[model samples]
Target: MRTDRELTPAELDAFGAELDALRERTLADLGAADARYIRRVRAAVRLCCTAGRVLLMFGWFPPTWLLGTLLLGLGKILENMELGHNVMHGQYDWMNDPELNGQRYEWDIVGPADFWRHTHNHLHHTYTNVIGRDDDIGYGLLRLFPEQRWKPFYRRQVLWATLQALLFQYAVAVQHVKLDKYFKGRISKDEVRPLQRQMNGKIVRQWAKDYLFFPLLALLIGANALAVLTGNLVANLLRNLWTFAVIFCGHFTEKAAVFPAEVLENESRGHWYLRQLRGSSNLEGGPLFHILTGNLSHQIEHHLYPDIPARRYAEMAREVRQIAARYGQEYNTGRMSRQIATVFRRIWVYRKPQAV
Candidate 1:
C-alpha cells in the first residue's frame, strides 16, 4: 500500500530520530519562558481590548471612532488567534497555569472551547489535508482543492467563500455539532445532542455579550447606541475576515498537497510528519505579523508539532526547513498576498489530477 511518497526504512528511522531530537529539545526548554510569554501576550490583548471599548464611548468623535474600531478589531484578533487559540491547544499546559489550561480555557469566539478543541485541536490537526478526512479543507463549503470531486454546487464557491469569511465565527461554532450530518443519518442523533446543547449555551453567551449587553450599556451611558452596535459589528467583521485569510493561506496554497486518505491509513509517525509538511504552507513575516497570526505564519512546523508553544515556532522553522531539505521534501511557503491569491485561485482550479 506504500506509495512513492513513503520513505525507505532507513530514511524513516533517521527522519524519526532527528524529529524526536527536536521535540525532546523543545520539551526540555518549555518551562518558565513559555508561561511568561503567553502571560505577556494575554496582558497585551487585554489592554488593547479595554482601550478600544473605552474609546468607543466617544464614538461621536470621528478620530476616536476610527481608532477605536481599529483597535477593537486588532484586540479581538489577538485574543482569538494568539492568546486563546494557542492556549487552548495545550501549548502552555506544561505550566499548569489555571487560566491557560487547555481544558478550562474559553475563547472570545462563539465557538465553545470544548467544541473547538474537538474539531480543531483533535480532528483538523490529526487528519490535516487528507481529501476525504480533513473537514478543514474547505469547511464543507467551497472547493479549495482540485482533488475534491467537483459538483454543480461548487460553481458558487466564490460567493460561498466570501460569505464564509463574513460569518466565519458562526460557521466554526456549529462545525463540531454537525446537525446536518446527524439529520442526514451519517451520524447518530444521540451523538450530536449533547454537542448541540453545548453549542446552544455557547451561542447564547457569546451573542449576549456582543450583540446585547454592550450596546445596552452604551445606550444606558448616553452614548450613541447605533455607533456602539456598529463598532462591535465592524470589529467582528475585521476579525472574521483576517482569520479567514490567514487560515486559508496557511493550508490551501498552491504548493500544498491534498492527499488521498488511503495513502495515510496506518501511517507511521515520521510519514505523518512528512504528510503535514506536504499539506501545509507558511506565510512570510516578521515579529508583528507572527504575533497577529499566533505564529501560525510558520504553519508547517505547527502542523508537525501542534503541542509546541506558539512562541517557539520561529526557532523551530529553520530546523524544520533544514530537516525537510535533507529528506528532499518540499516545504511550501510564500508571502501573504501570494499565498492567499493561490488559495483563491484554487476555488475554480477544476482540473485533472496531473494539472495540480
Candidate 2:
C-alpha cells in the first residue's frame, strides 16, 4: 500500500494502469440493465411532465395546482440531472439511440448543453478542485474555501450565496461565457459573441416552452393562465433550490479538499486520481435520492470515472471505498443533511464560524 502524498514515477505509472483496468472492467459490465434504467427514467419524466401540465390546467383548485407543480418540478429535475447530465456524459452512448445520444441531447435548462459539456465535462472534470483551473469551486460567486482569499465583496456572500441558490440554473448558464475572462483581457469580445448568440437562442426557446407557449395554451383551454404560470415558476424555483443543495453538498462539504494551483503543475495521472478523490465529497443517500441527484451523490466515484454511467456509481462506490482504504486515503462522504450543513458552514467560515 502506498502512503505517500505524491506518487513516485513508477507508482504513478502503476496507479494509472490499475485505474485503467478498473474502468475497462466496469465498461465491460455495462449492458441492457443500464440502458433499460435510463430509458425508464426518460419515460417517467415525460409522463410526469404531461400529467403535471394537464393537472395545472385545472389550476382553480389549489391542491391540483400544488400537486401538479410538484410533479412538474420532479420531472424537470430528473430531466436535467438524471437524464440529461448522464446522457450528455455519454453514459448511454453505447445504446446508439439518437434521442438518447449524449453528444446531441439538449436538456430543458437555460444553460446550453454545449457550454455545460465544455465547462463541466472538460473544465471541471479535468481540473476537479484545483483553484483557478476549476470554476466550480465557488462558481465565481461565494468563497467556499479559506484559501480563496478575502475581499470586501465576500462579506456580502450571505446575500450572494442566497441569490445564487435561488437563481442557480441561470448562474450556471452564464458561467461558460467567460465574462470574467473577457473583463480581465484573457479572452476577447469576439470569442464571447458566438457564445452569447447561442445562449440567446437557448434562452428564447426555454422561455417560450416554459412561460409563454404553455401558459397561452392554458388560456385557450379557459384555464387561469396566471395560475398556470405561477405554478410553473414555483416548480422551477423548487427544482433550482434542490439542485443547488445537492450539488453543494457533493463538492463543498468540510472534508472536501481544494487544491492549490502550484500543486497541479505537471500533475501525474496517479496524483490526479488522488487529487480528484480528496477534492470531492459524496452524499450518503438511498436509491431514490441517488436517482434524483443523477447518482452524483457518489461524487467520489463520478470524479474518478466520469465517463462511466452514473447509475453504476452506487455499486462502484463500494469498490472505490475499498480501494481508498487499501491506499490509506480518506473517501469523504456523509449523510445529505450533514453534508449540506457542512456546505453552509464552509460558506460562513470566512465571515464567522458556524457550527456544522
Candidate 3:
C-alpha cells in the first residue's frame, strides 16, 4: 500500500490500474440477487418519474389540479433526489444501452444531463471540496469560504440567488451549459449531442405546454390563473430550496474541508474521498430521509464509488468505513439538523483573502 501523501508518476499509473481492477472485481462480486433488486428499483423509479411528469402537465386547474400539482411536485423532488442522482452515476444496468430497455432520455426524468455532468462529474467529482473549483459551494453569488474571495457585492449574492431560484427559469436553463463553457472551455458540438438528441422536439414541446399552454388552460377553466401561477412558483421554490439545503448541509458545513489548490494536488483519490467524508456528513434518521435525500447520508461511499446505487449505499457505507479505518482516514456522519446549523455557521464565518 502506498503511504505517501502525493503520488509519483509511477504510483499514479499503478493507482489507475488498481482502480480499474477494483471496479471489475467489485462488479463481478455484486450478488445476482442484488442485481435483481437494482433492476426493480430502477424500474420503480422510472415509473414514478414518468407519472410525475404526466401529472405535472395536467395538474394546473380545479381543486384536483392543486392537489395533483402538489403531489406531483413532491414526487418530482423525490425522484430527483433519490433516483436521478444514482441513475446519472450509471448505477442502472440499462444506462449504457437506454434504447435496449426502452428507457427514454434520462433528462426526461431529471432536468438535463449537462446539468449533472457539469455540477457532478466535472465540478464536484474533480474538485471535491476545494473552495473555488467545486461549484457546489457557489451559493450563487456569495463566496461561502475565505478561500473564495470576491468583490464586496458578493455579500448580497445569497439574496440574489434565492430570488433567482424562485423566478429565473431561463437562467437556470442555461446555467450548466454556460458554466461548462466558461470554466472548461467551449463545449464541442459532439459533447452536447446527447442533450440535443434527447431534447430535440419533446422537451421544447413540454416546456411550452407546461409554462404557457398549461397556464392559459387553467385560466379558461375558471381557476384563478394567478393562484395557479403562484402555486407553481411556490412549489418550484420549495423544491429548489429543499435540494439546495440538503446539498449545502453535506459539503458547506463546518466539518467540510476547504482545501487550497496546492493541498488538493497533494491529495490522492483515497485521501480526497476521506476529506469529503470528514467534511460532509450523513443523517441517520429513517428510511424516509434516506429515500427522500437519495441516501446522501452515505456520502463517503458515494464519493468513493459514484456508480454504486444510492439505495445500496447504506450497506456499502459499512464496508467503506472499514476501508477508511484501515487506511487511517476519518469518516464523518451526523444528524440533519446539526449538519444544517454547521453549514450556516461555516458559510457566515468563512472569509477569503485578497490573494492566496
TM-score of each: 0.94, 0.94, 0.71
After superposing all C-alphas onto the true structure, candidate 2 shows an RMSD in angstroms of: 2.7
Candidate 3 residues 57-140, lDDT tens each? 454445655665565456656656665666666666434546312123253322455566566766787778776676666544
Question: How much lDDT does each candidate structure score?
Answer: 0.85, 0.86, 0.58
In candidate 2, position 275 carries an lDDT of 83
Candidate 1's displacement at residue 274, Å, is 0.5
Query: What residue runs in model 2 are displaced by over 4 Å at the alpha carbon?
Result: 1-14, 351-356
Candidate 3 clash pair list: 146-351, 146-352, 256-279
Please count the clashing residue pairs in each candidate, in the order shown: 0, 0, 3
Better of 1 and 3 by TM-score: 1
Give the Cα-based TM-score of candidate 3 against the true structure: 0.71
Itemize residue pairs with steric clashes in candidate 1. Answer: none
Among these predicted structures, which one has the highest lDDT? Answer: 2
10 residues in a row with least lDDT, candidate 3: 100-109
**TM-score of candidate 2 versus the correct structure, residues matched by position:** 0.94
Pairs in clash, predicted candidate 2? none
